[model samples]
Target chain A: MANDNGDDARILRLSEQDNVVVLIQSVPAGERLRLDGQELVMAAGLDLGHKLALRAVPAGETIVKYGAPIGSATADISFGAHVHTHNMKSEYIANYSEDDPYEAEDGS
Target chain B: MINSYLRQDGRKGIRNVVVVAYLVECGHHVARKIAQPFEDREEHDVHVIGFPGCFPNAYADRMMRALTTHPNVGAALLVSLGCESFDGQGLKAHVQASGRPGELMIIQRDGGTRSTVEAGRAWVEEALTTLQGTPRVDMKPNELVVGTICGGSDATSGLTANPAMGRAFDMLVDLGAACIFEETGELIGCEQYMADRAVTPELGQAIVDSVAKAHRHYHTLGHASISVGNAFGGLTTIEEKSMGAYAKSGSAPISGLLKPGDIPPKGGLYLLDMVPDGDVRFGFPSINDTEEIGELIACGAHVVMFSTGRGSVVGSAISPVIKVCANPETFELLWDDMDIDAGRILQGEASLEEVGKEIRNNVLAVAQGTLTNSEDLGHQEFCMKYKRFEPIGPECLPA
Candidate 1:
């Protein structure tokens, strides 16, 4: 079983070159945890398998994971904040979500 | 280490299956009814595979011919609705020429659905009886052809199941078995990494170009091949999902690039280009997981490995499918459907190498006739679609 408490939740830093870490369990927003001798609080509630910023990243900077550039940050992200679609975009292609109004066109 | 049967073409198979294939969508119901009785039979392996396209196509024709004559097949019963355009007789002749028993029943000429189903069922019954005489042969590990794919993937897929496949693939290659990794659309972010692993510089360039083509296809279609389930499972973008998907290929040097239905001449490791050639005008941008599995079987994969995080429980018609679960939580929910719990790595109970060895042992056991979960559950899922591709160039191969 996984621990859900902020300080006890496990996270994996995949590579030495990566700037994001993946949470092994869900952690709530406002829960404080320590990493690299710095105390940081979760910026938002996140579930298992979600990534979080390991350090501050500015807008348009590359977000590295698995030692590769997965995407670029869309805004400045502080340490321990959830890093996902709102803050990042892929370099190769655009994402198509079913909920996006721009993509859902009526077929005749 | 396998107790297999040798085909006239010299390929070996672990199962002597009787395939009842429908030439068009209209023939599907009758074909299914014909194949239904033997689905759960202990010794009889009768399954349905078909091309649903009514229009005649070279791609579909080739797929059907290759599949009907596949080594795992002992006999085939081709079903036709009597007017759609797939060369039913030509395919039957092709199968017979390849030294396999082939029979056709056209609904229009054979007294419609009721009579055709009755006749087809009778033919399948006799074929199964004849297949009982298929000679068993000793097959070595070097003769195995294995393929890998990841579907219904989530974050743990890359972390656990996919990388475990990578290690298993590496071990298979070292043991002189041919291994294939496909779905170039899922390899979007790691093109350069794949290119760098190619045995020859020319093959590397071809690898990169293929990924670029996939990039354009999805760009033109406005669909990134990422599913709603993937996003909900916490895959943030196509690139992120792709990075996870790429790990299934392991770290072996890529020996060649192949199109659908093209068997690898001699495979150390081969990258199968799943997207069709040319722009969006001629064909579809990408296909689903089950369709990709059909292509792998067409490429001569004796068995296939499928890794999943959100969970997929499909098995192919010709070969057994080994399902590796990525999420320990998902495993708890779908334990009866999975073969191996690769999620143990994510749960800190097992190392990747340990699971990789487990996968390798499972493959050998499966080759030696151990039933996978899907096989025991009778999940013989199969699908194929129409698509065009120019043959791969010589430069795309290692030799």
Candidate 2:
């Protein structure tokens, strides 16, 4: 949980109670990382600023960040696997995408 | 100490800018034509800001009044289409009452677009000359009102830039500066944490209640506060994006709650409620980043610290926006748009404390007439939309 690499290293655990650690840099699929006195390999490539599950989280469970519930998992999330909108959803409001905001512009 | 323009309202402003406002969408072209001649000139600071709504709205009217008489503005020129419901006369009168020079030109009353543009240009040209005589006074940190907003955010925003900004907010609060952190909609999950940090129990309850109201409102409106850019930048959910956005407020005990156009009563920390009060009658709380930035300026922010990871190239019309870049990659790409690169924390080059001090010093430097990247690039973006907000209650600010 401690690192001399930086105040925040390439992967950072923002709080002790947080169940996920955030990536400060992009990690490849075969990359190795050490957390909680154990070594784990990345299952897939993820970009910088993505999240990695610190431990296995079951579907329907709350996803925790900054020691608080950010939302809920839509599917089972494996440790060191990529966590994103594909696998998780906002609990307060529906999560969807808009391709073009002005789609109905008087239908002209 | 910063040498700043002094307003008769006993407030100090970092910039003495001339503003040309379009009362409705019809007047927009004429207003733009009046201000376009001075856009590239460093000597003349003329900006165009307006509301496009043709229907009369009390919220829009108040916002115009607040912005036209903003401490940073030395004079204002209001252009009206004359048939719109907006009260252009009332807006100009309010500006003049605040001791700033103001003028109104009705396009229908004055000849057409061409004549109104000529009149507005002549008025602004004269106003710029008169603004040269505005008095400059010695101002301290306490007199400075700073506002924070994180836009185009990513996962690194909370870890690197936001907390570093939090550290800067702590330092500014200690210096007796009034700093504001905003948007209850983005702060959905962190309600308890904020409530615990309030100065009083009632204030804490008010803080929690405001978040609850935001949750209900967004749920009713059927739109999430989390933008598509946030998801592409690796922020998954609204709560996840919100926790990152909320970090700019820092650990200061919140002093008060404010709606749009409400000035801070004293020097301390404040939470600006960007959400409207009643049912979701209007559209989204803020349509874009420029609208939020304009609201912060209307609240009397002398300067705004805008932290970004996806990269926003915007600056407000009245106040200079200090862009704090959270991602090193984005910083490299948007070098000309950013002011401070806080991604040093992620790269192991600088700690959060070091970056915090850098942001604090940058705020002071920009306040002392050093132009920010946006200010230098001629980005005076402004917008206002219709919304409803009831005045805050007593418990929101405990003496």
Candidate 3:
């Protein structure tokens, strides 16, 4: 699927098993998109290359990408809502905060 | 068909580079200064690569030998501080035995930094003249080894550049070329999937175990390889980035496992285990992208295909690096540094198969001595630090 311009591009679904679709271009809040014959509205401004939930996800549910669980949502995520670190947490390592030093512990 | 410089060990090199290596931190300045004058010249290509530790390590010694005698290298100059525990003489001897010109310059014996730099420059000039007479032979595609590493990955990486890289890797493997994809720590989430693609069930188990080892090692350090930059770029977790990074391997059955500097016996796909064996004494397996690229070079890769979503402008000292841009936005911002626009796959201007073909053609052009963007920009970045490892087991190399 080729998109001629960023203003009219569609979201990309990587796999049939993936629970989220990635935006090919940034979309502003209130923009309406149709997928699988159903209309969905962007709840917030989403940046390019960011993931949008394909369906409503309950709090604590795992967010799947590339057909594998990447992290769990911290709160209920609605369709077309951006899925990122602010709403999801890694199952492996804790996310870095502003208080942490930027360098690795060993300091190279 | 490509005409390449034929080394004594029945290997062909696309470029005849003279590398000046420093054995310790003290000698790095001298080595760099010696290479500075030749860097701007077109006829003579001089590169500086070295280890900074004063402590003796077998792994470092082996890596030094492998790099100096690499198929693409025709001559070597070893710079050493007087009291460092590294075996500078042994490395020089190995290079000479490979039918390449090798020389050693000790800082203290040569009257300190200024004199040693002057003396090393003189040696390199003579070495370049000697390398000019080296014979060239017809190099086949099967005679080449190619490697891939992903950096600055983002959400677009998994969709565009990496899978396109997989397609290129699959094509190379089909042509009997030795292809490698590495960073076991980055392969944390895809271990089981990777194991299933191994040539042998035993090798598959070994793949799984290696990732398990990396998991435990990183846990003790209280940090994963996932960086804050990765999070900012839309990668929320290590597993998320791993699924993208693992795509560079393509669908070929893994032929064997390799440690740093262990050359593959035959042509196929291989995995370079970057994590240290025994305990995690080296801090992190690789401090940056250059270390990973360095290990790939030591393992005999003639060229590296580096996929970047956020845009990395670094290259290597020994082999050429082809940068494949993953994000269309980043490509727009850094077009000069990128060689291929796999990001076009996202823009709808190109298909994955089309970008894959572009990468394959670029690889052939680079193997035929065309300079990649990184090479043209004079980005000869190199780094190798102290690291400990045990030799590979018989099971690791089943071929």
DockQ top scorer: 2
State the weakest 10-residue window (summed lDDT) of model 2 chain B. Answer: B223-232
Sort the candidates on lDDT, descending order: 3, 2, 1
At residue A11, candidate 3 shows an lDDT of: 70
| lDDT string, candidate 3, A1-108, tens digits | 323322234676665577787777677899887655466788877766678788888889988887677789999998767888878877754222223322223311
DockQ preference between candidates 1 and 3, better one = 3
Error of 2 at B118 (Å): 2.1
Query: lDDT by residue for model 2 over A3-103, one digit each (tens)?
Result: 55332356776666777888777878887777655677878887777888888899999888876678889999987678898788877632222221212
Q: Candidate 3 has which clashing residue pairs, if any?
A: none
Assess candidate 1 and give its lDDT: 0.83
Among these predictions, the greatest TM-score belongs to 3
CA shift at B192, candidate 3, in angstroms?
A: 0.8
Q: Write the per-residue lDDT of candidate 1 for residues B297-344, one digit (tens) a residue.
A: 888888999999889998889888999999998999999999999988
Give candidate 1 misplaced runs (Cα > 4 Å): A1-9, A13-21, A27-46, A50-64, A67-108, B225-238, B281-283
Tens-place lDDT per residue, model 1, A11-91, is 655556889877766778887766545677777777777888888999999988766778899999988788888889878
Give the TM-score of candidate 1 (chain A).
Answer: 0.73
